[model samples]
Target: MYDFQKTQLEFIEHIKDPDNKPFKHPVESRRMDIYRDLFFNNIKGFLSSGFPVLESLYNEEQWNSLARQFFATHDCRSPYFTDISKEFVEYLSNEYELQAHDPIFMKELAHYEWMELAVSIRKQTQKWDASKTVSNVQMSQLASVVSYQFPVHQISQDYQPTEPSEAIYLVIHRDSDDKVDFTLITAMTAHLLLTIENNEQLSIDSLNTMMIESLPQLDAEQVIQGIKQIVEQMIAQEILVPYSISE
Candidate 1:
């Protein structure tokens, strides 16, 4: 009598360990190897496509080694191919560490590279009118609006420069076309976006007031223009969609 749960666990354990006792027959052994190869290859392909810049940054040997390590260690939650990249990015952020003297921009660069594909595959069936919503709709912002405190744009994956420069703030968002777009934002702009996303109720004027106080160096007129420009850009990108209209 074959116990399904026990058999699956045993198979998993066997696949993970090279020195483990071999499974039953020639057929079983070959089948298990196929599964193991497919699993690793699938994950590697997904991650490589998602982080092309990172892939190019590292040599083939280094990239493959990192992929193998991630494959062995990360406990992926999704069986879907699309979700694998998300998990890989999370792993890179939480677990993977480059050299101590390695460019601080590396992490952000990996993330920036991943965003293009992430947004490209994102499901965005919900339709919202930009002009209408910005005028009268009540909306909730997304938590995924991340800003990295790194000058990632200046870093070239092809030409690894060796110097530390001032950090740049980045804003990554999925556009209306479902494409991911990245922009450099000021600290105040990043904060304003976070506040709106968190509170979901700050009027444009209120946001400007907060910006004025936060970025005193920027005059109110400049701040207003900047805010308008950002809002327009977000709308164009489809990051900001209409929520609900109030009577």
Candidate 2:
């Protein structure tokens, strides 16, 4: 007896690469071509939407060739359609073959694009009822404060750097308005956020003391006041959530 399940599996393998595999399906060739095109095109469309800039950088033929290779070789784990972008990144990071014409910052750029989507989708779990409901956590847990060697945020077709320069510091967070926003931060600001991450129970006074200790040559009072203002701005920007409202 002919096994339907085995035949279906064989049919799928052939569908992924119609030219290479012999089509064992008794179904007409025209109908099988539809299945092959439909399956691959949908995946390509999903990827194209996620990495629009990456797509733009390549010519149509080159893009289609890369898409075909990815479709044939990559085994995507994400069942959710929205997470296809994440899977694409995983593929690029692990298995993408670098071409001579491809930008050296391709991986960094892909990650930057993915980071924006990831931040937008991430939700805040802290419960706050106008100063009553208890929730305290580190900034690292609630936000993405990152530093990259490449100036990824500045990359475009018009401006592609061949070599690395100064570090790029960024804070990406979802605001009270439920929209994702990106801001450039100084190295000092990056240090402050990292310190808060390492010391989860940091208060304004403690942060000021640490700042003063680090920059001993500077006047303590001026440093403390400046640190306070920076922290206030961080709070206002929703980059850092304060444990105590008054603090």
Candidate 3:
């Protein structure tokens, strides 16, 4: 290995985790400390902003510990600063070891928060004509349907629940005006959205029929009316866009 390359790797390792990976290279302690603080603080600041709710649930020391763990261990793949939050979410979902102090809903809450940021910055590839009454409907690129065991949307420092509740469903979407918001939805609505999202060229009428068949206990007319209402509401919120058959 090249001398300079080895030195560079050692420097990064020390900066990422000073406590464990001590700097063995020829560098002044003051210089290394400055670099360590700069790098760690930058990462910590972004995490604090990205997961404000999660941060609030912990004390400053606890939050810093969590952030440092992510910095020291997770191998982030994205080069963009905006993607750090996503990397943190990935770490929580796949890599983080649950500490007893950690909330049970930590992973879900992190995901819920990240989705808001993700939807806000997501780029739109195609424009929709809201006036067009197209038969086929598809979920918008900027919209996401999520289900969690806890009511992630309602969780806060004062109201953290110890036990999981019934599965909660939510739809997060960005409107044409570029405002991001989420709506609490029923399990049935969640099912309908997922069905549309997974299928191509599925019309609302077809979905209504499928729902009626699946939920035979409900009156057919009532099911049709409920689906119609949900479809209209979703269209108005830009969660469901009119899909053009030509495309």
Scored by TM-score, the top model is 3
| Candidate 2 accuracy as TM-score | 0.82
Q: Best to worst by lDDT, what's the order? A: 3, 2, 1
Compose the digit string of candidate 2's lDDT tens values, residues 113-225: 88888887876775432454323324733468877777888887777888877888988777877777778999888887888778866666777778888888989998877
- The C-alpha stretches of model 2 lying farther than 4 A from their native spots are 1-8, 128-142, 209-223, 245-247
**In angstroms, how far off is 246's CA in candidate 2?**
13
Between which residue pairs do clashes occur in model 2?
A: none
TM-scores of the candidates in the order shown: 0.73, 0.82, 0.93
Give a tens-digit lDDT track for model 1, residues 1-247. Answer: 4687777766665554434544543456667779778776777887788877677777787777778777767888888778777778788889887765345567777776766666565565445653544642112222145555555555565566555555556666665444556667666656666766655545677767777887898788998888778776655555555443342
Query: Between which residue pairs do clashes occur in model 3?
Result: none
> What is the C-alpha local distance difference test score of candidate 1?
0.64
lDDT tens string, model 3, 1-247? Answer: 6988988898899899999988886788888778999999999999998999999999988999999999999999999999999999999999998999999999999999999999999998855754567677888899999999998998999989889998889999999999999999999999889888988788777888888998999999999889888988998889988877677
Best by lDDT: 3
Model 1, runs deviating above 4 Å: 1-7, 17-32, 97-105, 124-144, 154-156, 162-164, 215-222, 236-247
